[model samples]
Target: MAGDEAIRLVSYDPSWPERFEEERVALEGAIGEWVVGGIHHVGSTAVPGMEAKPIIDILVGVRDLDEARACFDPLAELDYLYAPYLPEQMRWFCKPDPAHRTHHLHLVPVNSQRYRDELAFRDKLRSDPGLAQRYVALKRELAAGHPSDREAYTDGKSTFISRCL
Candidate 1:
């Protein structure tokens, strides 16, 4: 776990998509052929009008984990620190500058279930405003109860996410 910060959900920022696009272009330039499918903006921040933790979650579909790993140096050059937080599932990278952490890159195989689930969840949230609102409420409640516990905050929403999926 990186240094724990209180979970703070803020109203959706209109600039989130632009931020994702900037990162996406940089990532595609850095990793070219390794990226089998296109990059996607997943997670709460991707949904318009959804209150979220202010972190942009990017999903990059690669040919395989090995190919993804090979791009570590390139990604690092872009200031993305490879954090094997979930090594078994995917390649995770986080920006070291916590104060300006505008992105998280999750690298998974193009056809992997994790990749599909994430895209589906994000799409569902975007298409269904009521569902998005319900998710926001759950996040707010969870954040209130587990302000300093990142694990708890994340776990609290598993059920809701599962249901959504």
Candidate 2:
């Protein structure tokens, strides 16, 4: 699906915290120690008072993508589908087989644009409650449609997200 329909927002669920911990343990064991610089649970789900997509987004930083590449075997063995957003651009991995895999692992090279952008966007949302509320409102509106229509939803929010970025 080229990741277009992956953004499905869900009402804030208290269970998300437990889900994150469960995921962190599984990922740390499956992907090995050094493959991740620091595995962070970012996105709205990570924050305490924000609505978010049901999916748990995990940010895995590495010395380089090569270090992350080594985890492909272990990760896939655990049912994660590895796909790069853009091979020439950067390397990251996720469970295309979402149910089978537990988390969205973005293995970004330290200090890269993509990494910075992810952090910036997430931090902006965290620090500014007004923007977070706006995001929540937009997501609620978007959620009325097909939750799986990732592309349509992302396209719709591009402007709002860009401003936050």
Candidate 3:
């Protein structure tokens, strides 16, 4: 419900990984049984020295979309709000609110293309500082252009992300 938040980029925080780990542990405890692949920290925050939106991006692999639907209630209990974004591909969630999120969760099928690509993109950026810097530049430009339009800001980065993938 809070999807209309402004876009703001922050300097890379050394503690992002730890923040992610903390959230990962919480997610595992709340929905471990439904996780088929693994819980991962992905997105810009996962890379060192990359400017990001200060939200920890988490990826949780489940058996399939149908099975994943069961997680809505549990995730809600954990204060994750479910968003019907790309329901055909995966289940998306944010906490504590979408407008001002501290974390983003993507529930995808184990071993799916999206699951693999997400990890691949993160790994690629982690290995290449130049690439990461380029991404950061793009992100800053996008954020400025779409300061209050999260969807447009994200859409603007698709081409760059696809090329990286």
Candidate 4:
């Protein structure tokens, strides 16, 4: 893997929302209306005043699995790598940065629990600074030792996130 693709935690940038907006608009233009139910700024970057890894995580909700099939392959043309094991009810993809990604794109059924939990968590974090601060501290500590292994990074977060769900 290129060192540029190295995943690590970093202080949050205030520009995450604007970056998401730009990507959202571009994704909407690229995918069109039929496949995209709703696109949102999700994950740690979506919360205001939170420290994050500078990745603009996006949640693209689709109406149905069939609709996703109709469009999933084309998304690959834009570097969206399908990750079928992400969860049963949703389709997940990682759009690697040709220039080193600062983002992760998630595709999900319009109303899945995963989607609900993500939104709920994001909202919860935004509404509760103490919790968000704890999460931020956890992430910083975890990333300090494991900068590039994705599984380790996620595992570090599961305990807290699982409780939130």
Candidate 5:
């Protein structure tokens, strides 16, 4: 919860996948049936051996936004705070607390471009160490330059991510 907007990147931890699994089970119990596709671990943390921020990024593929919207209450009951941060394409939710988020849930349509792109990017990074390393380097540079600007830090990586996709 401390330094919520501050950018902090750390070396990869083998525990990230396990943490994702734990969250996945909890999430499945909460709203798994409502989802069209299964949940996925995306982002830098999903890439093994890649340095990243210590937050787990989860992609929940739902049939549509309506189904995703319906998950707000159930997810909240499980400590996932719902936010209409990206209503156009996805429903955003953060776990534990927004101020010190441990997980981020992005609910998008299973067949949407965003969904495919995210998975593709993650898969590419997982398969290619050089690509993953470059991404890690970019993240580190962005974190150092915009330590207090979360939006800028994310925006800075958009280009690289798009290319990777």
Candidate 6:
């Protein structure tokens, strides 16, 4: 996490879905050979009217983890810097660089628990306004408390996410 960025939440932007779509198209053209399920726009940015960190988080479903390694170089060609975070669960990457990220890409196995959980959380946020608002409030509080610590801010949200699931 040497190049990790600070936690800075921003108001919801209507353009996030378009941005995700653009990235999804590029990603599909670049690595469609390995895609098994589909590309999804997840995370807070995917939920309309939710304040988030302003990064379009995309989840790409593949058949297997070992074979997904082939997607690394292709994604890098698209400016996605691969990160070794949660290697056993998913292949994580951030666009441009970790310090100034515009997107987060997660390559997960189609049938993996992590893939299901991510979509579940996003759907829950999308359908439940009160829950989404509460999540935003918690995020704001966490961002304030752990301004420069991305990991801490994320760690603080686990309990809330668990409850939602």
Q: Name the top TM-score candidate.
A: 6
How do these models rank on TM-score, best leading?
Answer: 6, 3, 5, 1, 4, 2
lDDT of each: 0.87, 0.72, 0.91, 0.77, 0.88, 0.94
Stronger candidate by TM-score (5 vs 6): 6
Worst 10 residues of 3 by lDDT: 1-10
TM-score of every candidate relative to the true structure: 0.94, 0.79, 0.96, 0.85, 0.95, 0.98
- On lDDT, who's better, 3 or 5? 3
Model 3 clashing residue pairs (backbone): 2-99
Candidate 3 on 1-165: residue-level lDDT in tens?
345568889999999999999999989998999998999999999999889999999999999999998899989999999989988889999899876789999999986899999999999999999999899889989988988888789899999999988
| Number of the top-ranking candidate, with lDDT as the measure | 6
lDDT of 4 by residue, 16-62 (tens): 89999988877887776755558889898898888787778888888
With candidate 4 superimposed using the best TM-score fit, by how many Å does residue 86's alpha carbon deviate from the native? Answer: 1.6
lDDT ranking, best first: 6, 3, 5, 1, 4, 2
Global lDDT of model 5: 0.88
**Superposition TM-score, candidate 2 onto the true structure:** 0.79
Model 6, 119: alpha-carbon shift in Å? 0.5
Residues 13-120, candidate 1, lDDT per residue (tens digit)?
Answer: 999999989888888899977888789999999998888988999999988887788989998899988877778779998875544566788999888888899999
Candidate 6 local distance difference test against the native = 0.94
| CA-only RMSD, every prediction | 1.3, 3.0, 1.2, 2.6, 1.8, 0.7
Range of the 10 consecutive residues with the lowest summed lDDT in candidate 4: 1-10
